[model samples]
Target: MLTLTHRDMLTLKHRDMLAFGHRDMLAFGHMAMLTLTHRDMLTLTQRDMLAFGHMAMLTLRHLDMLTLTHRDMLAFGHMDMLTRTGTC
Candidate 1:
């Protein structure tokens, strides 16, 4: 089995974010609003992780502004994940 360390995961997540273009973001939103496949779930997980990590750092610096966006992402990410996984 292959395993990824934290640093490796970060690198992969960053790469994924870069690979996801503006059009892809729109598609992701559409997918989130509807249904996601196993592959989409994996992609979303990576994207959300990258966003969450970024938001965490920003939260430390700009608490008021970034916090709201951070919370929104968490809420939306969780809702989407939960609904898709039947865990909600």
Candidate 2:
């Protein structure tokens, strides 16, 4: 297992913020590790951790929109993940 250096911790912190779209003036910190998945650290802010959880519930409500949803908008969110960005 790779022990987290200050730099690695900082990178992970940045990824967590970017993942949750929390682009505010607040300084976020890792309050907890959600889980240890394949050695990847999944940490979150106090507020964002709650928001991350609420996403599944929100997705359920929005799932119904799939039938009425426009194709362009749906593809926008996951266009990168759906396709390989020239990396392995």
Candidate 3:
């Protein structure tokens, strides 16, 4: 049996978010809405974690679309991970 850490799970979630392109935000939004609407099926903590991950992904995507500085992106990326893991 293999066990995954929370960091590993979050990494996979981030990878899924990165799999989409800028042109796919509309589709992503629709999918996210569907997922979020059914979030009642998840535990409160799970829902909160998912919401945080989605927000991080959206913010990163928005900044990318704006052609933000590499340093800014790096900072956001670091902050997102730390924030999500409650280490910030």
Candidate 4:
């Protein structure tokens, strides 16, 4: 519900910037406000990373990979035991 003017923001150190949404200042019109300074690219990269992370989570949820991996590990252990005893 409040805002910080450019002067107020400029007074903040890099470490202190986080409290003020400084990461979103990539397009502040003033040349000095840019960090990596590629505004569009930074925005796009953030969006893509979020999308990929969500997709990965959905895939993991659907595949139940942890249970499958545990089953495979148990199978491998049984095979190892059988091989040790020459049972198969």
**lDDT string, candidate 2, 5-83, tens digits:** 2222223222222232232122312231222222243322223222111111112121121111111111111112221
How many residue pairs of model 2 clash at the backbone?
A: 0
Whichever of 1 and 2 has more TM-score, that candidate is 2
Best-to-worst order by TM-score is 2, 1, 3, 4
The CA lDDT at 24 in model 1 is 20
Candidate 1 lDDT over residue span 15-88, tens digit each: 12223212222122222222222222222222232222211211111111111111122333432332121221
Question: By TM-score, how accurate is candidate 1?
Answer: 0.16
Q: Tell me the spans in candidate 3 whose CA falls farther than 4 Å from its real position.
A: 1-52, 55-65, 74-88
Ranking by lDDT: 3, 1, 2, 4
lDDT of each: 0.23, 0.22, 0.24, 0.19
TM-scores for every candidate against the unseen true structure: 0.16, 0.17, 0.15, 0.14
Q: Pick the candidate with the highest TM-score.
A: 2
Instruction: Show where candidate 1 strays beyond 4 Å.
Output: 1-19, 22-37, 41-50, 54-88
- TM-score for candidate 2: 0.17
Of the candidates shown, which would achieve the greatest lDDT relative to the real structure?
3
2 or 3, which is superior by TM-score? 2
> Cα lDDT of model 3 overall?
0.24
